[model samples]
Target: MKKSTLTQDNIWMKEPEEHDFPAAQDYLELLLVPDAAKKIVEDLKKAPTIIKKSKDILRASRLPLLPETNIHVKENLKKVQKNKKLSPILLMRGQNDLIIADGYHRLCCSYYLTEDMDVPCRLV
Candidate 1:
């Protein structure tokens, strides 16, 4: 089967400024979801081995995720009223695209809280 690659037009493919992981971690700490670490683990295990979803493939094309994406997330959250319940972590395989570094809680929460399933992400 020919894989459907991410196109440039995808809104999530927009370029982002450098992410400061330390700062992001600090923010995550403040957000402090209960069982944050464990959830990350479970989320990863739950994620599929062959993740063919176009949304996730688009996310991977961006390479390292941008840190300045929080602003976008806030806006997206307000717009979305229904969560899509997607996988939190998607492994980056085949041609060095991108992978879910961490932060499954933030992704899940952003989708649930804002209802926008297409949030910007970063790779580890």
Candidate 2:
């Protein structure tokens, strides 16, 4: 599959200068079904795995990432490429958006590596 044009430089990839934990929390509350939200949080508290899914599917979702965060992702990607296990991305099934609660940078990095990459994620 062709790679998505979406990247750190993309307009949709813009993020607040400061990490907005509260806003993210509020958005989750607003977007998720109560039980589903709770289940994800609970799952986060437990073990997470690197489940591979198509990068094209994720690109269609149109979730954004922080450019600054991408720097870290690049560094981590090097380690991942070297056989290190990075944490699973936290995703939420929202009514209108495929919300990425965490690990947008990792997703972007994986996209950079290969468009058809079976990117790893922890879906809720």
Candidate 3:
């Protein structure tokens, strides 16, 4: 399996942005099952639980990375490099798995930067 390319040594870090929430909501709506998406959106309306977790933790929590999404991940990595501040990734708890509602690419990029790197996320 190909590992993520992100590493903390090289990652261009930035704070979270305001627009990230809406973007995450939209992405989750498109990516998740309707019921799951609805729940997530409703959860987002309330205050999100902010957590700083390692890339390794996120990798273990999320679904496997698909090959088709690699290009988009790379693009996001570049965007992060250019602009350090990115919106926080959105995560949801499922019966047995953690869901990434948005910012998969950003997560991958952060993982590539360093597995142990701490990533801030808004999890519901």
Cα-based TM-score, every candidate = 0.24, 0.54, 0.64
The lDDT per prediction is 0.37, 0.53, 0.61
Error (Å) of candidate 2 at residue 53 is 3.1
Runs in model 1 lying further than 4 Å from the true structure:
1-99
Q: Which ten-residue region of model 1 has the weakest summed lDDT?
A: 1-10
Worst 10 contiguous positions by lDDT, candidate 3 = 1-10
Deviation of model 2 at 102, angstroms: 1.4
**Top model by lDDT, which number?**
3
Error of 1 at 22 (Å): 6.1
Pairs that clash in candidate 2: none
Cα lDDT of model 1 by residue, 8-87, tens digit? 22323232222423333444445445465335434444443331333454455554332334665454333332322222
Kindly indicate the candidate among 1 and 3 with the higher TM-score: 3
Each prediction's total of clashing residue pairs, residues at least 3 apart in sequence or on different chains, is 1, 0, 10
How should the candidates be ordered by lDDT, best one leading? Answer: 3, 2, 1
Residues 17-92, candidate 3: write the lDDT tens digits. Answer: 5566667667777767767676776676465546465555465576665343489777765666664444566677
Task: Please give the ranking of all candidate structures by TM-score, highest first, separated by commas.
Answer: 3, 2, 1
lDDT, model 2: 0.53
Instruction: Find the 10 residues in a row with the least total lDDT in model 2.
Output: 9-18
